[model samples]
Target chain A: MVNTVDPSGPKPRRALSARNIMLYGTLMVVSMYYLLPLYVMVVTSLKGMPEIRLGNVFSPPLEITTAAWTKAWSEACTGINCDGLSRGFWNSVQILIPSVILSIGVASVNGYALSHWKFKGSETFFTILIIGAFIPYQTMLYPIVILLREIGLMGSLWGLVLVHTVFGMPILTLLFRNYFASIPEELFKAARVDGARFWGIYFQIMLPMALPIFVVAIILQVTGIWNDFLFGVIYTKPETYPMTVQLNNIVNSVQGIKEYNVNMAATLLTGLVPLVIYFASGKLFVRGIAAGAVKG
Target chain B: MTSQSTAKRPVQLLRNLSAKIASIPMILTALVVFVGGTAWTVVHSFTSSRLLPKLNFVGFDQYERLWSTRRWLISIENLAIYGICSLILTLLIGFTLAALLDRKIRFEGAFRTIFLYPFALSFVVTGLAWQWILNPDFGVQGVVRGMGWESFAFDPLNNSEIVIFGILIAGIWQGSGLIMCIMLAGLRGIDEDIWKAARVDGIGTVKTYVRIIIPMMRPVFITALVLIASGIIKIYDLVVAQTNGGPGISSEVPAKYVIEYMFRAQNLGQGFAASTMMLVSVIVILVPWAYLEFGGRKRG
Candidate 1:
């Protein structure tokens, strides 16, 4: 198996090796397992209702149609509103953009402070924040609801954004703090020598150097805020439901016929944002997850 | 020293005023939301709060009712089965796949991307996909039955006894890829010289991994364990999306129960008690581990 006879020559043929065969075969099988669900979703979404009812979900559609996609986007009913997932899509976008910016903004600043400017009791707060990440969100759900209601932000889009920011702070702050800590202390000292203040050095020096981390943070937040069902469902009004919540309502609602095609289509639509981010930012997505998984 | 520090305190506070100001959100969140909110819930759990929370003490009546409720008990059982199985299977499959991928296999990138793409999508999407795939009429069972095996019963979603396993399948499919990625990183971090040393010592690759590499990767495994354990405790969306605790609430999980009681059933006291139990369970797992991981480090 160690083909070291001629170092510069082409490797000897091991195509039929048992180890190679087993490795590739297992990989292919597992790949098929992972690919199967997405394949079913795409095929089911593209097929007509009649084809779906024909009860062979694995087969490619005989007459492929984008009607389900259109219906899912524009006209499928979630409940009383027949406007499909478009409303939820826009609502998600509204939640995603602001929440992403606000959460990342506060987190980056907090990370910069914790990493560079070590005030008294800062590490205590940082430790608490990190541990808070492990506390189940359910324990704080009602209190947050009450807090948001008192502040007149409950059942509002901005309220949902605030919730996302709060939950997102722990992990995002951890990511940025770790990233910032990896920078040479001499550089921060030099910046301080130039009389740069807290926000100034952060915005001018660290921000530019941490572009990759920022991208990773954005990818993390975008997928997180987009795919959030619990917060969106709990915090927002019915009209302002995010895509995942709306998709669930549309699929699981008992008031109408079970249009599997449209349901799958809506599912795909809700998943599309994160799927695109995952594919486009492939290695960075891995890095983001690694960073998020660091505390764990 | 105390007098000198006290004299410098105001000056120190004013030195990095902006940084101190910036950290206010994090401090407030840690103190107010995580600490204060959790304390509030635990305290309120002792009261008879209904749709609206009040201070009327009930002396563990909520907890008593919660324990006696069949739904809550079923939720606990489902979570236990789901959590234990998910932990074991995810680590096993993830480690196996990572080991295979570490063998300089071709198309490693493509295989990893395929396995991990599911993790990118939400549990809602994963749940819906698996729900369709497990649908008795047109899914795996149906396909198998259509191939001249009429008596093949594979509908875990509908069956009361095995519904949690149905959700487990989706859970593993969505999560194991992440564990694999982490494990692969751990494997990559191992020195190639260790493999050469093993080869020179006439050790089998399987023995090398089990006896040597796995022990070396204990921290990585711990990280993955904590990740999976947290995810297991919060297994709500997948259940809701897949079966919605259906077929007579056979698949209810603690997180789902907490949410359903808190919001839908308008039972605030019951919800708080259930959520407090969840907090207790997490602390039970977290405290000793945190002590070992961080506490020893400080002392040493």
Candidate 2:
């Protein structure tokens, strides 16, 4: 099997050798496993209710229709609102924008300071922050609820935004800290020697130089906050529920007639934002998650 | 030293005032939230807080009740099952996929994107999609049955005994790609000479991977293991979306248990205890990883 196709050649491997067949065979089957669900979703979302009732989930639609998509977008009932997933879409967008901005804003600055400015006990605080990332969010949920209630921001989008900022701080700060620390210290010193203050060096020198890391941070936060369910459910009201929460309610609610097509459409719509970000950004998305995973 | 200390002590707080000011959020979060909040919860767990968090000092009764409760027991059992299976399977599948791609295969990028696109979607989407695909009437069971095997029985979601595996299927689909990507990075980090050396020694690919590549990739495996383990303990949304602890609480997870008690059950004490358990579990997962990862460097 090792050299059946190319025994006399310099390289013994062949394109269609038994080994290649097994390798590509396993990958092909696994890829089918990955691709099958998405295909079922698209096909289901296109078929009508009557057609889907035929009980063939894997089959393509007899005739494609966008009714389910529109209804999912504008008319589906999710917790008595019947306003479809648009409200959640907007809610997620509102939550996503502010959460991303505030979290990244605080985190980038925090990262820059931790890496460059060695204040007294800074390492102590930084160490605490890193450990903070490991603490289960369940343990801290009520305390944050109390804190938000104290601040009069409980059950509001801003409270959720603040939660995202706090939670995202650890990973984002680590990402930027490592990235900024890699930059030659001479650049920071030169900027300092040129009569630059903290904000000056940060805004003028660091921000522009850290564009790639910023993109990485954005890719990380966008999918994370967008796909978030627990926080959105915990922190926001039904009216202000993010897409994931609304999506769950819309699909899992026990009170309504189950619309499989609409549910598929709703799930697809809920997934589109992050999916677009994932595909469009490609390798950067991998870098973002890897950074989040292999903590420094 | 005393004179220098005295000279700089007065201006110490003022030094890097701007940087300190910039760090206010991190400080407050680290101190007031992470440390303070966790401590507050731990304290509250000792009290019999119901409806609202009041300091009643119940002396472990909440924990006693929690351990005895069937729901919490099932939740923990499910988490353990899910965690262990997920850890091993994720590593195996992730490494296999990584190795296949590392074989200089054609369309690696396309294959990876196909495999990982699910990770970008929310757990709700993954769950619902799998839920539909696992539907008894229209899903795999049905499709296979229609193919002429009338006695086929693959319905796991509605079955109490195998419900957790149903959720496990969805969880793996949504997660293993991350481990694959990480493993691929580790694989690429290996020197080309290692592969060349193995080839010159007339070693087979499987032997090289088993005896050589895997042992050398301990750090990467540990990273993946730690990531998967911690995530398994936090499993909530996927369960909620997929099973919602359905078929009579068979698929409940600890995270879901924590949320239900705190918010819906209005049993704050139980919630605190359960969440504290989650924290302990996370620490249990992290401590060893930390020791393996940084113990030598930190201590020696």
Candidate 3:
């Protein structure tokens, strides 16, 4: 982003010069490629079914309609349930709030301990935990199912919340671990020298200073748990399916008429939360994901 | 090992008790779920554990059955094709976009926001959008035909032969931006002096990139490769939302096969074997990278 000058480069010229044209031209084409689906989804969602069948997905609607949006929000059915995606939306909210809070709370504490406390064999456990992140969730899914069944939380939203917390721990812990480790060791020593124990330092000093990373972790988990289809489908019954799972079922269910307009509307609705988070917390979202690429 | 492991002292055991108490969730997750669970599955895969994972050791039967199944083979082939193509194209496209945006051009932020927005959407949303776009009647093919390109066929989603590629198109759109952001960070990390020296040598921009910049950014490339490779092995929701492994199960992948057998078909042993194979593929991809990244380093 820094405009470091290249002394040997072409002279500064008008905006419509040959080089500028080529550069902007390529960028514009690529931009369109990225934006086209969103454009199509919105355009298709706004048109009625008959008009959509006329076969111009790129055109603006002649007569716009809000019927598809309402239908997708309330009237579209999945199986015996004729109620639309609002149920799934609320279910996701139920899953999202607790999962995000519990995961970040546990992970932030774990990160603080690993960086500052350094107990026996802590690194071994930490290494195993980090390596666990790369393990395919399919391998671990059944065992966790059995774990949930034993506790009688199977097919419940809280069970899915626990599942999200355990799976999310590795990355969130690492995100906070690498962050807390970079803090000067002197800060911890100073706090300890003042006779402050673990809880006092963590609650007073670490919590306030760690606000930004908390935002990043929240963004990561909110978008992740909301967009999760696998855990939602596997852990919860139809009554508690998350938005993504229900969206897929509604759009892909074989029994229904293929209502493309309603399907697009539902798809857009499913995607709205994450898209909003990504746009609103633009650079922090980038930082959160980029943290994954950073090695221990 | 810390002093407590060797000393076995009571004080060391009680030292930082709150920290250790807090780490119980983490320790249980690492030891019980990740390690113990994987071992349990691998062990059970050898048993005749059907319908409810009741173990009655039947060594290699599940493996034999899995290898001989037609669906499993197609899934492997589909994964191999998808993985290779996705890797090459993502790195190429990701790096190229990074390079373009690094040009200090106008509206770089706007360009990046556009390119990366799809990464924010779930695969379910992405798949359905593309599914509608690839609809044979009212989608790109129809639009193209209506625009006078008669006889032009482009319906990959419904066609069993190329359904995977149809999924691949949606996959790249949703994922490449993350790699782009990573590669841009790597490009930024390169000293500006490198570019100055390349320009001084009169080397072209593309040449300088291939010969100098890319080779220098090997670590970043590896990180991105590992991220993409791990992501590629778990391509379930996208396929489910897109084709549902349709056209007579021609588009099925290993994850879907595992899910189908274990959850739906009541064949736990088969799903166990299929999932174990997935775990193996992931380990094969991960171990070498972990060694290269962390094995040699010493903890302070």
Candidate 4:
């Protein structure tokens, strides 16, 4: 398959090499492996129930319909309400914006302090937060619920936001701290010599320098907060459910004949935000990961 | 100089006060949120609470009962398997992809983006997609059979023993991107002289990767393992989204079990008891490693 000899001419023929053939073959298979689910999702989403019943999942249905898409968006019964996941879409956005901004803002501040100031017990603070990131949220769930209930915010959007912020602190702090640590310490020292206040140093000196990493933090926090399900489900009341909760209800209903088509569409719709982020800032994330934000 | 000194006085005072007060909020947050919540859970676990958290102390009975529950026992076992398998698979695949991409390949960004995109999508979505892809009659099975390869099959989701592996496969897809990014970063950070030295010594690429490159990336490996380990412990979304603990509760994990007992089963005590066990186990495994890594004195 590789290095086929030329018959007429003195020149060597650049035949299809074995490595090329193997690479192309493997890449095609792997790409298909990645694409299979999306392909099936698209297929099912476009097909009517009659086509779905025909059991040709890989084939385009002879009679295709956008009915499933419309139904999933507007009329599919997710719970007691027949209205689809679109009902909670705004609630998701509201929760996401505040949670992402607060968590990132606080974390960047914490990172600046921990990395630059090196105050007493700052290391301890970082350690506890890192460890907290490992504890299963279920372990903290009962207590958080109790605390929120006692404070009368148990089933409120504010409760959910607070919970997200608290949980987000550990990873975000760790990320920012690690990043800020790698930056030249002279920047902070210079700002200090100029009599920059702590806030002044952070705002005037560190903030401008941290623009790229801040973008990374924004991407991470947005994707995470947007896709979150447990906090949204457990903390927020039904009226303020996120789209994940709605998708969960629709697809994960215990008593129904599960509709694959609607489930796929709903899940895709729920993930659209994170997927957009992935496509948009994916390279930045790669480079950001290289930043060694949590190597310790 | 006098004017400067006078200006510095208020600034110095504020700095001192700020540092003094800096920890106050963090400690308060940790106390009220982490410590207070943990204590509350511990107390509730000892109580005979149900649905709305009744506060009558029952003492170790819930823990005793949780220990005896087959599902709880299975969850612990499942987590161990899932954790180890997911970590290994993610590390292996991620390292390979990272290494491949680091070869200065053409269109490197495209390949890296392809691999990393999966991490952005939530488990709820990826799980659903995987569910359809693995559906015995309608998915990969159907596609292969339609191509006249009727002997092909991937029914792990339906089989209990294999279901964990199924979950592991899906997890690797979603998580390996993170590992890849970490490993790639670590690889790229290597000193250029090492590669030059290897080349001068006439070392092949395979030998170089195994002997030289792998050892140097230990920090990133450590970071990747930590991230993956945490993910393994808290892996509820994917299993719930994909399998729903189905094939007769065969794929049940601790988190899901805790959620079920807490909410649907209306047994908050049992849920907290299971949670306490998970916490203890995590600390047992992680605390020592953490101390060695974070607290121990550095080697020469």
Candidate 5:
């Protein structure tokens, strides 16, 4: 793919000086500002109640212990059970894997059809999906619950998976469609001229070039489906709840005194996978954004 | 010639047929699941459903009740304040971060990653983490008091009036990373000549950002506004995690209200009613926005 520079001249680089020093200094401080809460959470989680009592939140704990993590993983009481969030780990996996796969697959098809085939009402479909993206998931919650009940899938993992896929499809489709539109029309024409069927052209030609975007779609779907709470809580049966639901229960359950350490531990544990994926895929995700897939 | 042409005709026909057939499943799934699901929600809201959805018509009584309820009223009012504050803070912070990073700073990738990674985590965790940090007894207050500032009281979770601001802080942290990316994209899209021209005109950096650059970022602003505004309306998990509508229903939002009534409270009628109102509001805002957004593209 070609990197298109602006037809205009480049801006001359500004030299660094005392003013620059102050600007960069301020920016670094702001970056620290952004990172403060996470730092506080980590340090506090490492401390016992005694050290936490001493305040001085920025300081490393005089004594560190994994006790909070241990409690959060296995001993934290959610309701009547102290099973922690381990029970829901498998449930999140069940929802996350299949939902991402199905949603991405459908999005790939939607993108290809909208971009290449340009069928009647295709633009209308794309427009509707775009609009649908802005409708908060809350607006659809009640009806979705009732619909699931009618289909006998409400309170089931299947219901949750379907809901995730429905919501995931619109943005996923938009991402790929916009990216695919940037690919040369000549490539598609050549494939068609070479007697390639529609699916053949997509599979043999377009799919390989789509790997970068596929990585992005995967990251998005995984993070989104894994982090989802409202849908998981509302649609899936309790046994099938994701880690987010478990974390919510452990953290927000109203019956007793809150355990800040255990709550932070569980929250961090639940978020670990996405955070890992995010750091690992930061390069690709950034490149994907620079591809302008989402820019108007 | 006859054989070749006849073969091509069938192949072409098959290609067209399969394309049409393929779209059927995708289109139908979207229609039956999403559109149909949304329609069912609106219709169910009007009916008197409880725990389980029943088809008994209750007219607009649920809607009437929703308006009169203090909880519903408070939820909307709180959401407005939360949404506006969050939108402004995230935009300002996000734009600053993006602009700063664009200045060819040290470890640009690392800094960007540090800033952007927060967005990848679920709000459930982010909310909980913030909850712990902001809790009066155990969090910042504890630390501050231990440092001998005995009067320090950073406990928004316990106070009703100030709790909403506490919630907005967390939302901004989670959302700003995304806005940063969008703004960065817009910044990178700017024509180099604009910057050169500004420099030639002896424009100060601050003046350039305010006058020349910010105005050019209209698309980015619109994108950010649309995305952020929508998310704010459905903002449930963060508030729940941070405050759980604490201090006696002080922080309740529409989404949480709907959820509570749906299952916990078993007032599904009101749940559906609240949802219906939300959906109507969404449509009301979205229809015009969608038209302006899409209409300009194909026509303009």
Candidate 6:
């Protein structure tokens, strides 16, 4: 193989050049830095208290165990409830499913209307919505509470679902509107000429064609509502606390002996939903974030 | 005559009614929640509302009290420190990583996946993981001490003076990857011919990036800056998770202050005042940027 090489051809260099070494070296260090906490979390979760206390956090467990994960999932205490993250996990699922569906459904229709069936004063409201995205949630927090209380939905899961829909409207609407606007006008016009009304055309032409954007929207909304601590805390009671709020309580609760293993396991459990979505829909997640960022 | 004219007007109004009906949610949100809610908060900030909202109209008293409060002052100061440092460090680290990744390196996807995974997790998870990793007894300090540097002291969660920096480290860890992705996108958008031309002219890569590429990526940088800045202003969960504003309230932030006063303290007026201040701060940052971004576009 070496003899077959032409002398005039580019010379094959050694595998680790100085430039290559530096590039790879820097990347490796940063990657290690990024990976270190996850490693610590996994390792700490696997070790017993004796092992955790005896060794530094970075060490692999001499004795492997799933006790902490089990405790975190089923038996760890958060306040009076001895039930672990499973309660919070189910609560998150309840909130996640509805919030995702309603927000995407409303945003898609809003986007379709804005892009295709523009009426007087629509653009003005759209502008206001986009600008309102930058407004801090604090500005509306108390008022929303009062509004929800007035409607007798305060401290309920439905209230949170409504809040998520209101908040998610701006970004999701922008996503769908931009996506719909990018579709060639002729397709919309063709549907119109064939006597398709607004709902009919939307259901037939737009929904199927915009499935990718729907995926992007779903990814965005699921991660967002799942990871939400502020709304979950403010809108829900102790019985309905989402996974993030419950996880924080379990880890940070002052009354108990600090179970570092259980805390790490709980943390991992709370993060699993979005992590799974992220790893599974890798490029789509990137696309979703990119779409969210560009308009901001 | 009036009835017939009114009937004709209703018919005209019914034109494109489906679009209008579809937009009711956006309209209600924009007008009722956003505009009306902000107005309500600002108005009530002037009142002496205790538990429930009341319009007792005590002009600027809440504001005065808020400014003079020690925790509020500390919170503002921490926000300033955290905001400035997080902004600079995230951009620097993010851009550097992006540049490294942009260099046609091996294992780009693996490296990116590693970096961005933390971002997928919530601030709560990030905070907890870092809190454990930074714990004094069983964490970095202990590890180093075991390695024979017994005097090494690096516990930001406990030290009041440097607690914000501890949070800052975690913040950067979770956030810089995102900035890297955005920066990489900006880098990819640069024309290949620009690099070719620069290479043909014997301009070094570093010099070209510093002198040319950065300036070309101005909009991308601005977008990233706005995103980071907004996030910094609303930084509550991370603090709640990591420090809970402990080390005697050294890591307290504005959002936490607002929430506590509104709910815990049962002082709606105070929360209103604090939230109004947050609104003002956001306006201070947003208006000029918006003007430059949208207004200048219109004028041009």
**Residue-level lDDT tens digits of model 4 in A74-130:** 877865888887887788988888888877887888887777766556677666666
lDDT of each: 0.90, 0.91, 0.90, 0.76, 0.78, 0.91
Give me the chain B TM-score of candidate 3: 0.95
Where model 4 places Cα greater than 4 Å from the true spot, the runs are: A1-16, A61-64, A115-120, A178-196, A254-258, A287-296, B1-10, B19-25, B43-47, B51-60, B146-153, B191-204, B295-300
The CA lDDT at B197 in model 1 is: 78
Which portions of model 6 miss their true places by more than 4 Å? A1-14, A294-296, B1-15
Estimate, for each residue in B148-260, the C-alpha lDDT of model 2 and write its tens digit: 99999999899999999999999999999999999999999999889777877878778999999999999999888888887888889999999899889999999999999
lDDT of 1: 0.90
Predictions: Cα RMSD each:
2.6, 2.5, 2.7, 5.0, 5.0, 4.2
- Per-candidate iRMS values, in order, are 2.6, 2.9, 3.1, 4.8, 6.0, 5.1
Best by the DockQ measure: 2
User: For model 6, what is the error of residue B250's alpha carbon versus the real structure, in angstroms, after optimal superposition?
Assistant: 0.8
Q: Please identify model 5 stretches exceeding 4 Å from their true place.
A: A1-16, A53-57, A255-257, A287-296, B1-9, B51-58, B296-300
Report the C-alpha displacement of residue A47, candidate 1, in angstroms: 1.1
DockQ of 4: 0.38
Q: B1-300 in candidate 1: lDDT tens per residue?
A: 011245655535665687788899999999999899999999999999989999999898999999999999999999999999999999999999999999887788989999899988998999998999999999999999999999999999999999999999999999999999999999999998798777767777889999999999998898888889988898899999999999889999999999999999999999999999999999988887777677846721
3 or 6, greater by TM-score = 3
Number of clashing residue pairs in every model? 0, 0, 0, 0, 2, 0
lDDT of 2: 0.91
Give a tens-digit lDDT track for model 5, residues A1-296: 01123244553445566656776787778778668877877876777766665555577878998888888888888788778788878789988888988888888878887788765566766766755665556657776766788889988888888888788777788888888889998999898888888889889988999988899888777877888888888888767888999888888887887666677777778988887888788676665443322321
**Candidate 1 chain A minimal-lDDT segment of 10 residues:** A1-10
Q: How close is candidate 6 to the true structure, as a TM-score?
A: 0.95
For model 5, the DockQ equals 0.40
Q: What is residue A167's positional error in candidate 4, in angstroms?
A: 0.9
Positional deviation of B234 in candidate 2, in angstroms? 0.3
Error of 3 at A238 (Å): 0.6
lDDT per residue, candidate 1, A36-109, as tens digits?
Answer: 99999999999998888886779888988999999999999976899889999999999999999999999999
Winner by lDDT between candidate 6 and candidate 1: 6
List candidate 1 stretches off by more than 4 Å. A1-13, A294-296, B1-13
